[model samples]
Target: MRDLHNRISSPSAARRVTGILAAALLCATALAVPVTAAAATTTGTSDDATPQLANGLALTPPMGFNNWNSTNCRAEFNETMVEGIADIFVNKGLKAAGYQYVNLDDCWALPQRDSDGKLVPDPVRFPHGIKAVAAYVHAKGLKLGIYTSAGTKTCNDAGFPGALGHEYSDAQQFADWGVDYLKYDNCNNQGVDAVQRYTTMRDALAAASKSTGRPIVYSICEWGSNSPWTWASDVGNLWRTTGDISDNWSSMLSIFKQNAPLAPYAGPGHWNDPDMLEVGNGGMTDTEYRSHFSLWSIMAAPLLIGSDLRSATQATYDIIGNRDVIAVDQDSLGKQGTVVSSVDGRWVISKELADGSRAVVLFNETGRPQHIATTASAVGLPGRSAYKLRDLWQHKNYNTAGAVSATVPAHGTVLYRVSADRHWASYPPAVEAGVSEAPLVEAGTPVPLTTTVTNLGRTPAISGSVALGGPQGWRVKATSPTRTAALSTGRKLTTSWTVTAPAGTASGAYDLTLTAAYRSPTGDAARSELATIAYVVVPPPDGTSYVSDLTWMSATNGWGPVEKDTSVGESAAGDGHPITIGGTVYAKGLGAHALSTIEYYAGARCDTFSAQVGVDDEKGANGTVAFQVWADDALVASTGVLTNAEPAQALTADLTRAKTFRLVVTDGGDGGDSDHADWADAKITCAA
Candidate 1:
């Protein structure tokens, strides 16, 4: 049977780099490259420094098996399993399906390198040198790939043949072993500049690639820090856009949505990798795997198999090797997917393929399922003539004569490939144009604002996250989808958030930056420009302003010996008077229940005001504290009091001018229970 093996770099090189850094070193060795000395750009340059296949091998979506998902190093690289996949790729029609690379994940390294500082393969597992293993795999027309890290140690605790400072040596070692692919991971080390760190390894890979005269694919594995999209092309052929992806839907979608904004940088020879696919990992359903493959194809991400393909189910094979979908991803035009619309926890992403065809995905990330629909016009397609739409997963074609609508299951998706009819001339207007902003208010104000996003793209943007920044900590206190939303093109959607300012928050005009990001089903992502608007936080008015005590004044108030449910006093009126709530009373209520309060006031323009109370309960817990405010007269009649629960964790709300405020004993009391409550530090500075 034909065989393939992924080789780690020489041990001596790994040791020097590992010990020198005293930390984990992530590194990689490009496979099958031509050894040549050519100046490569390491800095951010617009010049065409694209990588090309050096050896006879051509870049055809390097496919193969990865060991990280199925089994750890608990078992040596299962030689039988490795050989079995190679056989299947050949005999079971996989090679014809364009599957070529057979790579090993982490954990195949011995504890130490040879005397010459070269990596020693685990003799127990391979018995044969890596060269012999490569021969077996090559005989079957398949290439080999291996793994390493930028840190001192491989993620699987293999030998720490450091690549951080020894990238060139490690690359040379892999070249000597006839290596073909490299997956470089960043796991350990602190304060290391990511760009410089990865750039060093990239340079080494290029050097080794030239030294061995073999073409190798450099796969970078960073947990998507500082935005790989900004520099992925300049660094490595492919870069992981997120942390390790699990074999579940959540992890996959999380990574997918996270990569949405990085789509524009992906193209031939350079790809955005969202980690390996866990298609046959028994974690997600077949439907999920289909969605996974569909979205990845649209994004133009590198297609690397992470699960054991030797024993994969038929369903998994069908989904992973779908030809029609693969064509969209490998389109010669090299057009990757771009986000078009997102809303209510769902997204619409569209890809313009080289065939003059468009692939669109409607994704839902919310808890419940949803239905999304848009006409050809909405997706920026000409409607003069009808077009043929095909469902990639369903393997069926439909004539989208009018609108395109489909029911999306929760955490599910719908993918479509549409081909335009040349006969069509002018059609209905598509999508919407322009962006609008909701009303803006000052920071620190107890107010919430909603922003509506309208789509104007040629296609809908798939699932993505929307972030709005104003003053620091200015977050979406409340939003419809809460986490993320998937919206369709031409659709108008709104997301809301509350405004809260932390203590010592400076007053200044800040830009409200809104960003909607998502990856193409092809794996490329486009992060829209940062939407901006200026808003100011005006300081509180200074004066003897009336305040509220809604914090504790709203609760039932009563003196000692009061029953658990006693109403001692009626809510007092503000009457344009700043009422100071003081004098605490213990509760005789049963169980651990304690005091409660309710208060209302107005005109109090203070941000800081606190009251202290002392409680004496032999068996009761600590006394509780609360801070709040209630609307007064006119405001009260309209909106009423907004009471905050007791047990004030932080002195947040203002109680400077409380209307009718009093503390009632709430806990550590029964008919015979006895306790005392005292209050002090009752003051409010409404003087601005």
Candidate 2:
């Protein structure tokens, strides 16, 4: 990969001088071999230079497996595991997919150094030593990566030698052991300046590479404390932009948000590292992993796999081996993708490819499918030009003359490679729309239904009208029906209609239609319509089966995430936000009690109160917490000391028949350690 960046310099100084003279003599011939985007954007060149210096090995973001997310705190970092992983890479086809390094994150070293102050591999774990391990890995056609800290002690009690005072010796030893990559971490720095400390090791690694004729990919893992992207590129190949990522969606998305904006700092060898990949980890769904991969690719982030390869599933292979997607990350442009347009939980990102094509992604992060549409102009492509739209993942090709629209499923993505060509003569006028309305509506109430229609077409819509149609008995009135009908390209018009459900409408899901019509120069009219905007109609309250809409709560808030459970299994994310505590997998109520609360109204037609509460973090030590149920100003029921390992505890209160109730979660003075509280199956029963 490094050779791909530039022609190798001749070994002799005289030969290099000759090449320089030749390049000067034939400037046009020298320009024939184009400079790669990655090579030009070396960390400090213009954008994201790390505070620490980088070694410039990860010109494209590094791709490989790290052992952290899989083994966590208790890994027996050994020669056997690394060699076995090398075998799995070949047998599992990961080697063909470009995963090279088999990295040892931590705990691979003995707690104490040798008599000569040299780092030692754990005798029990690696009896044959790291050199032998590296040889085995290299023999299997894979590179070996090692980990250490910049301080005297590592973050964990791995007893690993910090590369502070022993930078030269450590680098020499790593080179001798055939270590191809080094993840220099930040822990126990003891007030030493991080920049100075990391640069010391970076220089040591360079010297070692020079002395040993071995190039090691240096990674600055200081947790982005010193803003490595601002300076690290000159010294290292990649730098950590954020802290670690949990095997969950929220944490993953948060990390991307932190890293994407630093795209400019990343090019060629210098990349903004967002930690490792948890693609095969069990904490998230397959859809979530897909989104995770998509975001990382566009961000030009490293694709380090952080799970056990020996037992990986097929879904994991599909995501990690996505060739088309990987090509985007490894694109010679070395461009990191940023969120260009975002609204209503939908995000669109575009990256300019080296081949003059544009890589675009329509991402849906919400809990349901989102209707996302964008024009070529919106994505920074030539709007008047026709392009070949290839769905990279779906393997489908389409001839789109206007805005590209897709119904991306929750946590799913639509990745397209748009390559321009002069094939079609005329462009169609496109009407793109977005509808915003309440998800639930009660009979006899009015709700705002707003739709924004845009002329995304390159051509103008000379005469047209945008309309909102609904059920026969519903009352609907639009503010500006045809205001944007005769607009030019890129023009937008908004129409808002107040809709009142019929007094006797049944409780079920109904569709609201939004249609936009345009007249062509030939006097022919064309229409684009969103036929179904799903809105649930709450039925008339009967003697039973009445549910108080949780969204109607006057106030609801929580620490961490106050997730609205659109479906069950929200608690499975292990974020302590959702958990099942009763017979039903109830997910709509409070989960995990980090000083969280959900206050709701019972209204005039209220009856009994019931909820099943429990703790969800079974892996951690149980903490003492209280889940108290309140009816207005009175205490109704309470579950005392909801321990982490405890089963579902029931709380049924006779509602004083108050018009309101609140679920208050409190840390029982233990400071909320492992207090994963869940108010599963909570309900306000209202009957005649």
Candidate 3:
């Protein structure tokens, strides 16, 4: 078997350079890519001739648990762990909420096959063999899924036997052992055709099902290398549309971008798989995880849990077990969501539901709060005067007069179930409110903030008033009229406020609330509240200071936590080594992976920012990345592309009066593989 760590690259520096140049062009244009309303033809395949499977299974994308992202080939990935997960599923409401399979990933079999050419379960790992484990899971009312490769050997360094030429026998063994699902991987195939290999296993599974009177769901894990979406619908119930997913925002975002465009290829029995769920893997925040779940559900992908349930948190369970969100994935319509609009990191996706409703997702991919708005007609909903909207995450319902909008948090998603209703006027007017201003403020300085209240309900809003409040010691006062006599449907009332942070305030994020109080024309009172963050910052003292030593307003990384004065490591804080770029070690700097950003509250006091940027030497010659420096929203400096094969390049940005400073690293267009980047010897000089 081939070592997974030594996987193939793009083959030449020229190709990498082209990828980098393309990425640079994208960055110059707000990272814009052409948005398609329907699935476009994939390379080398025709979707029109793609067949559909009649397996009578996975009519909806499978909802299950796979122990790969959380455990991989660790010692704890044994029978006990699998059974414990089944137990959690039953006892913790996951099974009740629709999770069924308790799946095993790689490393479940012995190193060699038995004398009769049969695979053997590792004695120490599955003491009672796989059949007993399957029985245990079945006893708990859940099914079991097993893993194997289509090649001569399975992935992983242990090199267990695969079902290359023995697909019939292996399928028979799995069916006899009561397996209900098979995750067919694509490693060590010796260059076999992806479709041919997968179809062989599909046939073998069908034969085994006929003989054993049991159905098995086939998942083709070819990692989308061969444009499986164009042809795999006939071969497997679900097919992976992208490479393996790391538990990070960048990986998830990239996979979503790849899968969302293939919406037209997915349906009742054949689904596009964007790998598995990483909801509770600990590499992302609760907000980001929610976005991941929402996006997956809207895409109509399989809902496979990829966390260790034995030690999972309540938040994790809550996210995975959200029946409302899960229903969108398992909708009887089975139509995948299409991108309604995507511009400057704001995405609006809409999926048609079975009950004459549409599931809408307002996703903010940027690094700050942004107001995303759309309309019922924009998302293919029938023209109506009013619509009923249910907020999936908040579990609240509101009435909208054709306008769908929200101030989504950074890296957050707002999901809604929108249905046209003639009786929407009976509900209270939906007055949406939000505040906008430069979030960063110098201590004791007043900043102008604008609060907008829009009446989106069918009825008119009467006596509408808006107010802004901050911390106890801070000052906030409205500068414009805060009340309106009558605001018609779709009309907005804008109010201005001057907010001042207390002098000597410590630098950090502070909470602020914007409240809009109104009454319907029928005399019913209604209120809407929005919470936002404001950063109070103090400039660094006179002289030069290491950037890593200063406080950052926000930090988002591609893989693992950002490191202070170190090289980026894998998925853990402070696990990195000394900051090293092209074999040179630096004692002071920030270590981050690609698709990362670190923002500082410069407070308009910094004069200059400089750093030596490159792919970290810790990745050897296997990483490619680009470095960018931004002053507020303007790009001040950039290094087009840097690979581990090149030496560090110097970057400097003028920050004479910039209030905020940002350091950004992006993947070099190919993908974020081993994109560990270093900002070595980073420094900022500010006046006292």
Write model 1 residue lDDT over 1-688, tens digit each, in one string.
0000011133422222232122111110111121122312224754575443223232334556677677657574655566667787898776787778787766656766678776777777666866667777788999878788786665544445546766777888777777788888765533367778787877777788777787677887765544555566776777766555656554466557656655556666677777777787776666668778878878887677777776788888888778777776667666567767676666788888766677888776542335566656666676644666666765655443545555455456778787775422122212211123322344546456565444433344456555566655654465464233554544655667665555445443344556556543344554533333333334334643222212221222222121221212111221111111222232321111123333322234554443333332221332232223232311111111111222212122344443222232322211111112222233345554
Per-candidate Cα lDDT values, in order, are 0.53, 0.67, 0.84
Candidate 2: worst 10 consecutive residues by lDDT? Answer: 1-10
Sort every candidate by TM-score, greatest first: 3, 2, 1
Candidate No. with top lDDT: 3
lDDT of 2 by residue, 485-511 (tens): 376656777787787778877655465
lDDT (tens digit, per residue) of candidate 3 on 1-688: 1222344442222222333233334323323454343444433334565454578899999999999888888899899999999999999999999999999998999988999999999998999999999999999999999999988887776678889998999999999999999999887676677778898999999999999998999999876666677677778899887667778887688778767867877888889898899999888888899999999999999999998888899999999999999999999999999888888889999999999899999999877778999999999889987898888987867788888998877788999999987677777777778767536777799988888999888888999998888999999988899999988888999998888998999888787888889887779887887767788877776778999999998887877788999987765688999887767889999999877889997878889999999998878776788999999888999998789999889999998889888998988666536788999999999886
Q: Which ranking of candidates, highest lDDT first?
A: 3, 2, 1
What's the TM for model 2?
Answer: 0.63
Better of 1 and 2 by TM-score: 2
Model 2 off-target regions past 4 Å? 1-56, 73-77, 423-688
Using TM-score as the measure, name the better of candidate 1 and candidate 3: 3
Q: Please provide TM-scores, in order, for all candidate models, with all chains considered together.
A: 0.56, 0.63, 0.90
